[model samples]
Target: MTRAKLFSGILISICFGLFLSACSNGESESKDTKKEEVRTATDAMGEVTIPANAERILAPNMEDSLLALGITPPAQWAIGTTVHNYLQPQLKDVPTIEWDLPLEQTINAKPDIIIFGSPGSIQNGKYEEYKKIAPTYVFKEEESADWRKQLQVMGEIAGKEKEAKAVLEDYDAKTKEQAAELKTAIGDETAAILWVIGKQYYLFENSRFAANVLYTDLGVTQPEMIKALPKAEAAWNPISLEALSDLDADHIFLASLPNEPGLASLKASSVWKGLPAVKAGKIYEMEDPSNWTSNGPIANNITMDQIVSVITKK
Candidate 1:
């Protein structure tokens, strides 16, 4: 071979080697980028540290909050069979440990943690029992007030506190903006929020679920009839549909209760057609049950959007 040709061949070999090396380096960097980070956060119970990436998460309550943070657990414990229908689509596939959790089933799963609301469930001695199986957390179910706080707390337990904070902050800002828009759309209109559960109709005051958003956050006025009702004893109180006339407001938010007897009775009542809101078609029927009672991060957004839609939709 010619001397020049030999030198050229050597140069080509060196270039090929460098190209392979660059490709290998790029592959390594891609793998590193895909690696999951070990996240940590603190809650009221104590400091929760999820080692590396938590592969097997078990959530008992606050499924909506977990769904909001884009985390889906392998197993979850539902408040009841009916509650599962309220969860987001991603969470609907997870297996539930039944309404009242069995101690043995929880221990057998060997979950990293167990999250639950309803202080009674925690205080009833189940919390201690479950802690033996995993780190158990009890979050409050204050429909409007404690949802964000609880989401942060649960996020820490699931090793996703930063994500939780971001989700909650965005939800809060959007809720504030939507509330302002709703107030402007319904200016000076008195509104009342009510649910027809079983055979009774319940009007929510400041303390009930979603009431704080209407009464305190959006600054919407309430009718004197509803205002005169005693403060909700426990999130909601049952009222007779016979008293519908007493609940007269410029606008009425009738929570969707599919096939609920109270709803049928109200529709059938002779006085119902005469009510101002019903006659004027000012009643807004809540199609999404999640918006009525959920306190999760996504629920806040849903509620805000629904309120704005009902108030502004022509």
Candidate 2:
């Protein structure tokens, strides 16, 4: 073979090798880009890097905020057979997940991100275990308490900040309109909320659950009985029927589960029957107490509608 021909053949081999090296490097760079598609977010547990485009989200009790932001989670929060009935219209098809979020069930759900309602919700020191399945974000106690703020934080986590802001703005406008209507109907009459579950009775303090929507947002006057009580330490605080005899509410929003024995017991009690709201026929019965007992954007909105509808009934 001629030397020049042999040199040309060697040159062709070198060019082919370089071509392969460039393609390999390009492929590696593409993979790295895909791997880096995440953002560092500060949760209650501190900085956590989560997927920028998380698709399969699992926020148990905060489903209302998720739904408000137009996101559907893989599972709804439930305790055995109990689930938030008011939210079932939107989340009926979703599977039920334990309130504490069991490991095997979470793994089966295949969540890309798991946003917990509060640090307390991350029980049994299983935060690390959940991290193995997907990124986890936890809300602080105070942050979890305020549903509006919960909505905003979840929005930031889900990359829907604008949607969160818009939701609040629209909700503010809605409350403003409804507050005016409520003022016209009730006219400074004090209102209180009574939640009956089974044989237990719980009362709402001024800022707990949907009571915040009633007295704070919608301008419903808080009864002296409710105002005298301390701010609620938990979602539900039991108040005895005897203590409730002192209630000076002109209107009482009675929230109870269907077929609850507590309602019958309360109705039979002379103290309950003698209450001013009951005597005046101002006892507004809310058959579905799901929203009143829970807190979130969707929950609060439904609560507002429920209060307005009952107060303005012709």
Candidate 3:
């Protein structure tokens, strides 16, 4: 063959090979794009049909639960500015609303659904107004302690019930394991959980609040004094600082409000320093104020870790 003809033949062969490779690559890319378009069920507050690619969402209080279920809403209906620190990274950009109050900003967001952590304030009239704008769901106050149930309800609403259930089961198993370990480490040491609010304090009893996890879930015994306090229908009972000495627990899990004067007052009080738990250096200060009262999924996990760490560390 002539040299020019031989060169032309080699060039054509190379071109043909390149064309086939490009076609193969294009086919694979098309398949991958189609697979990526596939949608799955998302469970939020209740059973609602959500597109696998739901763009706009509004989470008011249960940010932790939503995060646990891998649902990151584009917007958050926040009660306060500081709450942003508590939200998962996916929700940090969401705007904040007036704490526990309905603001026009939230309504303007035009979200598909609004999930509330606390609905009592909204129930009086605000919730109805919100319903006119979008589907709104309030967490069941009765199931406050059952975070798994809360997640399940959220998952069902978001159309991700199965995922929520699995997440709940996993969290429950971890909690149970940690609780068992905490029980062994702490042994029979009695503990009291308290929140320093303003100049007063509130003690949590086993049946009253989520603090029951310390007793019911973690197998920690309640201090006799806290157990003897007058039981009310509420989760916590308010007591005077003068009564601090009466809460004779082996250890005290005290949560103070950040930048609040309550801690200063408690420290200044002679009776507080004389308490057996205080003198023995058994007070575990909780840095996260939300964990002291929040019943959300992340808060529950935070509480469990705090309990285990405090008990086991000692």
Candidate 3 local lDDT, residue 95: 61
For model 3, residues 97-170, the per-residue Cα lDDT tens digits are 65554556767676777666554546455766776766565666654336667777677666678888888787
**Candidate 3 residue runs with Cα over 4 Å from true position:** 1-55, 88-90, 100-103, 117-119, 138-140, 143-145, 208-210, 230-237
Order the candidates by TM-score, highest first: 2, 1, 3
Candidate 1 structure lDDT: 0.70
User: Could you give the candidate ranking by lDDT, starting with the highest?
Assistant: 2, 3, 1
Least accurate 10 contiguous residues by lDDT in model 2 = 230-239
Largest lDDT belongs to which candidate?
Answer: 2
TM-score of each: 0.76, 0.90, 0.74
Candidate 2: segments with Cα more than 4 A from true spot: 1-36
lDDT tens readout by residue for model 1, 1-314? 99999999999999999999999999999878656444344434455434345556666656677788787766675656565455646667677776567887676666766666655655456766776776655554452137767677666666688998889678667767876787778787898887876787777876566776677667788888867878666545576666777767888888865877778888889867888988889988885555666556666566666777878993
| RMSD per model, one decimal | 6.9, 3.5, 7.5
Which of candidates 1 and 2 is the stronger one according to TM-score?
2
List of clashing residue pairs for candidate 2: none
184-246 per-residue lDDT for model 2 (tens digits): 887999999999998889888898888899999998888888888986786555778798899
The Cα error of candidate 3 at residue 114, in Å, is 2.0
Number of clashing pairs per prediction, in order: 0, 0, 15
- Clash count (model 1, backbone only): 0
Better of 2 and 3 by lDDT: 2
RMSD of 2: 3.5
TM-score of the candidate numbered 3? Answer: 0.74
